[model samples]
Target: MTTPQTPILEARALTRSFGNVRALDGADFDIYPGEVVALIGDNGAGKSTMVKALSGSLALDSGEILFNGSPVDLDSPTAAADLGIETVFQDLALAPHLNAAQNMFLGREKPAKGILGRLGFMDAPTMRKESQAALDMLGATVRSLTDPVGAMSGGQQQAIAIARAVAWAKGVVFLDEPTAALGVVQTRNVLDTIRRVADNGVAVVFISHSMPHVMEVADRVQVLRMGKRVATLEAKKTSMEELVGAMTGATVGATS
Candidate 1:
């Protein structure tokens, strides 16, 4: 029998509510290092809530979160970032006027040394070089780093976003509907970039509704139904029917 590895990121009994509605009810999730875990669910299944909670964008009323076996309080996005957790929301959140490199280092730009650093002068050359390296690491194809993101293609823009997350996250990166409106080729490129991220030893939590994308990119599938993780299935072993059943609660307690 294979021994299970300790999860790099884990959430247990994560509960949250809004007014009279409960968004999450005792949700549990865990992902091992260097693996891509896809989180899937139907509408209002609480997948978004869970992602927000994990990313420190939303607070849980009650629950426990552990990173690398140590308990943590993800009360803010900055707190999560400090702990090596990064998130790429569905919106991509890139600044239109900024170039790819500029967007990548928007808030975390490097400062020049000596008096210039004291004057808040950014080290543009170093930032550009590092940004280029980060994009190159993901094998992302782009015309120029100086070109504004708004001027780039959708695929190129998405690539930069994913690369930015990977460049900063030391433990886990959460991607929400990353390939939602992209073309086939663009989607493929993004998927390939995601795999490269996992290959680099950072755990990935992919939030998406596309079954084919999940099957193609994920090592495991996690089904969330009504704020609970109904089942966790090996991507290769479980069929789309099984995944759908779990999501719809038709096979909640059934073995895959």
Candidate 2:
């Protein structure tokens, strides 16, 4: 549970708004390479808003974002992607008709010559090879990359989505409620995948309200309340009751 040698992503005093909503007021956060930091909060606590700002899907009304300890302007999702930031939102966006390989290589196909460009060129062998490697990295047991993702189990589909991001992106990865809808075994699969990603030197931001899940997988935990970062602690040093109390602003609980 030690912090990384360097922070891959850091947000200092990050503030944003939608008209008078006043979402994410002076929120400060940082994610280190090879670490998974759980982000937890109650409803309307601005968790999604903070994630959007970091993903560059939404801009900060004020404050700053740092990539590799340097200031950065991630104006759009594409901009963030270019800097190796990938988001695995709950809606995976996989084409139900497309097979795992197709979904994994969606939009960012490797360029080659000939009809590969005409209509829709695909280097099938190469794409499948890459997809297989990514899946194997996380121990995904898929019968074939030719199988439609929709035909896969809830856990396998979730693995594919995370693998897709890992295959292409080399920087920070954000999991927005990744395990919310997974069954017990499936949830374990996703949690294992997250550890694998972090072990591979990619920083992971896991946004979840499930305190027990957070306790299980997070190296550290950040509690957000009223759109601000209220507390952060090493996972083992903090108890679930402490986390709950911190999020709820309950006194006579959390250790100082």
Separate clash counts for every candidate: 0, 1
TM-score of each: 0.91, 0.88
Model 1 reaches what TM-score against the true structure? 0.91
lDDT of 1 by residue, 1-256 (tens): 1214788889999999999888899999999888899999999999999999999999899999998888999999999999889998877889989988889998898999889999989888898899989877776777788888999887788888888998999889999998875777767877898888888788899999899999999998888898888898888888888899889888863322
Report every candidate's CA lDDT.
0.87, 0.83
Model 2, 180-199: lDDT tens per residue? 76777667777888887888
Candidate 1 stretches with Cα past 4 Å from truth are 1-4, 151-153, 253-256
Evaluated at residue 4, the lDDT of candidate 1 is 43
Sliding window of 10 residues with minimal summed lDDT for model 1:
1-10
**CA lDDT, candidate 2, residue 180:** 73
